[model samples]
Target: MARIKPQALLIQSKKKKGSTRVSLATIITCNILVILVLLSLYATYNHFYKRPTSQLGEELMNTENTKDGGAVKKFDLPGYAIIETSKGSITVELHKDSSPEFVDKFLDLCQKGYFKGMLFHRVIKHFFIQGGDPHYLRAAEGWTLQGKSNGQLSTSLNSPKHEAFMLGTSKTKPNAKGFEIFITTAPIPELNDKLNVFGQVIKGEEIVQEIEEVDTDEHYRPKSPVEIVNITLKHEP
Candidate 1:
């Protein structure tokens, strides 16, 4: 090339540097825009497709522990029981804090299989269903079964109400050989505190309703026997 002017060379050098700087700035801006678009896509995917960890945890906890308006109250008992009847199964959570002794005794009876094969002998429609009468299971066993009374009352804060699906001990007469139990189909406020509410039907209100609506005789005994097939305990995990 022919000799170039020094001033022209300097001007060309400055213009080349400016072009390079502009190219670098343009590249940086494009990279920043791409990163922003990727971040927005990720946020939208999480919002629509993925459930938050906190919400999932909350739902799981609710499944494990729940309270119903007309059924079982929320409780953290040591264990629960499943009463398998001819109709279906009824899951109940015992009220240990209020009636610890009664709950222990009830669990002990369940462990001994005392309730197996017993019939839901008495079922008052829209009122209650009674069972656990050994006399009905084994009349020759010399057990004296009697109707429950309201002599005993509790004042503890944890004493469960005689609401729908509440499990209460059927108080027998003095010197009775065996015990009885009843489950309310409706809120019997008169029985509140008068009867010992030891448990609540948590997951089997539908089963209870089925038993309650069954045909009964004039004596309130179920026409078709509703037998207690088994009683199983579920301990805390």
Candidate 2:
């Protein structure tokens, strides 16, 4: 073969260098894309599947440490209610600061015995235990009333953390209605400010969990009736 020219050799070297640079850049770009995809997948899993246990603990601690600080007009007293259930009793502390109206209505209903002997009509494990539907209780008594108005207690969406034992009112309007209430069995961050969070369990969390873990029908109604035997209010001076 004829001897290659110096310029030709230099040009070939430059081409080789350029090709090497392009290959390195392609490899780096591919690695970055793979890393980004993995990061995105991790984030998605964290958001939907994985419970952020540490974060939840922090939030719970914050909620526990929260004080009323005269946030709303004080109730007649500061205390909780004892909900006597067939399974056990649970004590719930009303969040009067954030949801004064809802608390007042709940207290009024409790005092009126509206929740007496009401079945925990709906319960989902790791979710919530619901009751306070007088209609359901009446229907169980074979006295179904069609179009009979259930007692309505007006409420509004309140910004309270929906953690385990937090009480939420069923919404009839966008942000109103409080005849039915549910006690969360776990952190329900999705319901924050959507449901009227009126109270939280101050005692007997195990009882709440026990009710939630009870066997239920396809409609989530408890197979063995878990009734609210009574609700007795307490006042602290």
Candidate 3:
């Protein structure tokens, strides 16, 4: 080997050390980047797939629920009803297993054209819209039907939750006729166990939202009536 100068050796050693430091820095940076990417992926998965559905938040579902972005699960209920309204149609899935007598009576009434021309008399935003009074025909004289007594009102609290789009009977009040029905605009915990939820809006939830948003009077009655044009029943397996 040629005689190496001490200064040249020192310079060579410093260069080697600098190159090693650069490689180490590069490896550390790559590792940090990988970690950050993994964390980001996990967070996204959790947000979409593992997010809990029990809490209320800016998401209307806390009180007002919308459809889950996932596949729509089919429900095999005993009966279903398509409520044709002035604004649109709302399809309700009845839970006869939970509220047998109530469902039977409601279906009987539908078969007899009891709900036709009934006005959605009461509408409270972010709360619910009440109808099926069987006797509310104020402004909508021609479009409204005079409902007869539903006889003895009967229902069960064994049904599903009082969540948004749930079809429930009137609250338990002194001498409540029980023929008055309401659809929840949100999760109403206060009405839970105090009323009967006999059905759910499987379709046309937007119509319910539209009805709930209608202008209301001081008594929560809709200023402009939202009429139930008719109810078509479906006996499903």
Give the TM-scores of the predictions, in the order they appear: 0.56, 0.56, 0.55
Residue 79, model 1: Cα distance from true site in angstroms: 1.9
- lDDT by residue for model 1 over 118-235, one digit each (tens)? 9888887656788977564333122112222332222333423877788987443423557678888766655653467888999989999999899987667789999999999886
lDDT of 2 by residue, 15-89 (tens): 888865557788999999999999999999988667788876555535532257845332244457889999888
Error of 2 at 169 (Å): 0.7
Deviating ranges (above 4 Å) for candidate 1? 1-78, 134-160
- The clash count of every prediction, one per candidate, is 0, 0, 4
Query: If both were scored by lDDT, which would come out higher, candidate 2 or candidate 3?
Result: 3
Model number with the top lDDT: 1
Better of 1 and 3 by lDDT: 1
Residues 185-222, model 3: lDDT tens digits: 77665566455788999899999999988887666678
